[model samples]
Target chain A: MSTVKQAGGRPRESRVDHALAEAVRALLSEHGYASLTVDAVAARAGVSKAAIYRRYATKEEMTFAVLVHDLREEPPADTGSLRGDLTALAARIGDQIGRSAADVMTGLLADVRADAALGARFAATYLAVERSVIATLLDRAVTRGELPERPDSPVVHALLLGPLFTWPIVLGEDPDRIPKLAPVVARIVADALIAGALPPAAQDGLSGGS
Target chain B: MSTVKQAGGRPRESRVDHALAEAVRALLSEHGYASLTVDAVAARAGVSKAAIYRRYATKEEMTFAVLVHDLREEPPADTGSLRGDLTALAARIGDQIGRSAADVMTGLLADVRADAALGARFAATYLAVERSVIATLLDRAVTRGELPERPDSPVVHALLLGPLFTWPIVLGEDPDRIPKLAPVVARIVADALIAGALPPAAQDGLSGGS
Candidate 1:
């Protein structure tokens, strides 16, 4: 008896994945997070729902895939100086925010709130990638003796992203403000790095000394 | 025919308002942002939907009211020194996180992501209150000469909350880790304030001399 061999290799079309990702990105930009739907993505991509499902198990997974694909893998070029490296990194981040990334972020945040599991997954995948990139940059600075060899690198990383996230999203500042703020932030980071690297006793006297 | 006016100037019921606010907090804790609903809030509050509508007009308003009611009105008590004041503030924030405040924050962030207008409202009501409180503490530090006046006061305020918001929520670290990190963060703020307050040439040489 000849058994029908089920074709288990290379089962899906790569085009479908690309289309779905694009569709999800478009929908995220247009509708923000609250109104995004799997059905809408499938329709926008002009692909069968079955095809989309074969790739992604849920809307959350699909949305996450798009973000993963979009997030840059490495920090911008080093430029041999901390200020230049940070300036480039800040500018790239600012560009992303101007591209309606705020809408995508809002959607992802909403998903995390709705489902605890999704929140964990989102953090593990998207946030971890961005943070690791920043950490690597700071590590480079430490190796070059540009920053102190303290345990506060993580705190500095948070300071960089926190204002970027909070000002527009929470404080309702115009996106145009980021360009001006980027240099100011770079200066603050420079000062903090310089001061943090100093010896404890000597550092204490500087602030209080006439 | 004589028309009679409602008792207590438009017949507002304090009991209904309190119930609605409590219901909102409960929903935030239990269901987070995506699952919370105005209908559910009314049901849980044991009040007519019309009664809730009369007070809030929308779920966003109800959520705002709950956050306003729950937010800490002032920074922790003065400890006579900047470090002591900061330690007390960090501990108070830690307490809030240990309670239901983290859940409320998760829900608020989710709501902001799903709805731009709702996010704006959340920022104005909830985050603004926190910022103002931190600003007050930093202002005290400046007065005590522990912090320099050169760095914008808002920047100093951001330095305090930036780590708290970025690490656990954005980076998804354990909330319990905040207090452990607070002292290092305080040091950075202190250093930044000192460096910024110095004259330009002195500021440039402060980090290099050490």
Candidate 2:
């Protein structure tokens, strides 16, 4: 998406991009992901099929972009403490859960299981934002002497988000339960960090050979 | 499925069930979940299609049963200490992961997102077994003065099995990494327990009203 046009003296591309994104959300809200189509998006946005194709090659990519577009704007507020940052970020994640997005995530995660390319895109597009934010917070925590060092990222991700993601799905809670449960999970994570329960330096080549 | 037959003079149903389970595993490995069919399973097992139909109502149900069939035989070992028990349980979860099962779980979980019936069955059939074992461990830990009280179960489940499930998928690690990474996660959960990082009661109606 580009800058504001006319009053701000920006390009026409801005309006088209906004319409495209708005269309995606409206259609997603109206009909679930399964029924969403590029033609419908083009018709709804009044943006040409050619323009939509120019931006995203497939319906899936278009949907992914729109779904996570909010991450570009809103980040957890800098609350000036490690616990506050962690809790804020966790709460940010919790707030993201709504009926429609949750439905979409379930289907998306299933596809991600076997598709490495899509998984990488998801990492780069969606997860990387959180990763960068979390890294900033953790590094700041180290600077402030809250932690001796940043704990491992995988475990950090797990503690920060694992419960929020798995709680309702695995435990039979209402899908809406994510918003309520997030704070409790965040507290558990903050406590884990305080107790030195996190390991330093996340490893990719996990485990020693037996 | 019934008891062992012939040699022990138990019911004949046991052999049919055994053959059916074996066939399911073999087919799942051979063709993957998408291609796995009741017709193929019956043929492979030399069990009649009628027998298979009598047992499972659909392809999804049959697959779910075969995939989780191992849980019926193996509960996580009781290692006599809270940390040990948590680690042991986590390790058991890790060991269950494999290529075929992971593929199937991805598909199944996608369906579980929208279908409450499947979700409840999953909790009762699979998660409930782990739940029972974990509850026993937490209660014993209380008796031994290891915890103030049993920690909130949703958070406990997240710490125990979250990273193992999410690490490979979310972080782009090999699906095979689960077996190795499981121990490390187990250690984290145990340390969280020692540090009192877990909460005492998991609420379904979570969060203070905003």
Candidate 3:
């Protein structure tokens, strides 16, 4: 939502920013990350290069902005049970990985390798934002006491996000496998939390009961 | 180890292949995947460009050869319990991902996006090789009765390898968190196996004694 303010105190045109983002996304999809260029984005968006420079410090920043714009807003509140909340969250995450989002992500990896500065920005902006969202959901589960606090939130977050991103790369399969992954990961994490709270002996054979 | 034989009766020069692989690895570590070229590799290896081409039809093949050469050999065979086998396997995997191996893997991703033919070859040679190795190890576990026969061997393979690759990209941390990851995953999978075999009521709680 941040916009540049001109010297005359007028807000920069939101329409231009929107167009630039669309152009960037289109280029990212069509030409891929390796071929996308700021100049091309400016030409396609019909915005002056100077306007883009005024809005984003660098091409990497522009790409980061596009990703941020495309990312789904945080999961909606009031799904009720932890299972429902997670199922909804997983579905959204899966969708992002399923379509153009995966291409964008793969392109980002290429961009990151090509430019170290871009990689750092991507880590800070795109990855950090996603991690924070997952962490927030995990925190909610702990507060609700549907799960115990023992597996460490970040570990659980990694467990969930790790498989989501990795499936396509390692398995060479569709990201829609979230329907399968969500339940398996959710069950494992739930079991770990519940097991961690129990005595060692009691934890040994614990199974399906939540 | 399969190599296309020369039809004219002269055996292929093993040295050329070795030199090309070494050159490819060096170039990957230095210039990364984007900058690597078959010509540069041939030059660096002091081998004729024709010699390199005769060995590898493309740069992708040379790169794949380098990766397979760099991958640690199939894990050592042992009669140890499932926990020991998994722990050792995790450590070995961690070592590979921890060292320059991970950089090579990421570089491969960039190359895959740059060339479709290369991507297909890379996936078949590298990804397929890694999956086969993991599958072999897991099969040993099944034979030992530590794992139940699941028709989903491929899914389990992905679940394991996915996290290994995902951690570096998603968390931007050491992929060797395997020490922590191994036991947790092993425990979960082991429980899933037990759950598959046991009666419904027995599945709910973790009792220490049999």
Per-residue accuracy of model 3 over A2-42 as CA lDDT, tens digit each: 44332233445767767887898888878777677889999
The best-first sequence of candidates by TM-score reads 2, 3, 1
- Worst 10-residue stretch by lDDT in candidate 1 chain A? A1-10
Question: What is each candidate's DockQ, to 2 decimals?
Answer: 0.20, 0.44, 0.24
As a whole number from 0 to 100, the lDDT of residue B23 in candidate 2 is 91
Candidate 3: residue B186 Cα off by (Å): 4.6
Error of 1 at A157 (Å): 3.9
> Over the stretch B109-177, how does candidate 3's per-residue lDDT look in tens digits?
655646667666656655666666656766676687766652244455555555555666545655545
Candidate 3 ranges beyond 4 A from true positions: A1-14, A64-83, A101-103, A146-154, A176-180, A197-210, B1-21, B68-85, B101-103, B146-148, B175-210
Q: Write the per-residue lDDT of candidate 1 for residues A1-210, one digit (tens) a residue.
A: 000121233424556666777787788778776678889998999998877676655677677556533333567877787777777776666555545565566556555645667777666655666767766777677778877653244455666766666556545555665665555566666566665643332233221231
Tell me, by lDDT, which candidate is best. 2
Q: How do all models score by TM-score? A: 0.69, 0.81, 0.74
Lowest summed lDDT over 10 consecutive residues: which window, candidate 1 chain B?
B1-10
- For model 2, name the residue pairs that clash: none
True contacts kept of each: 0.29, 0.48, 0.32
Supply the global lDDT for candidate 2.
Answer: 0.66
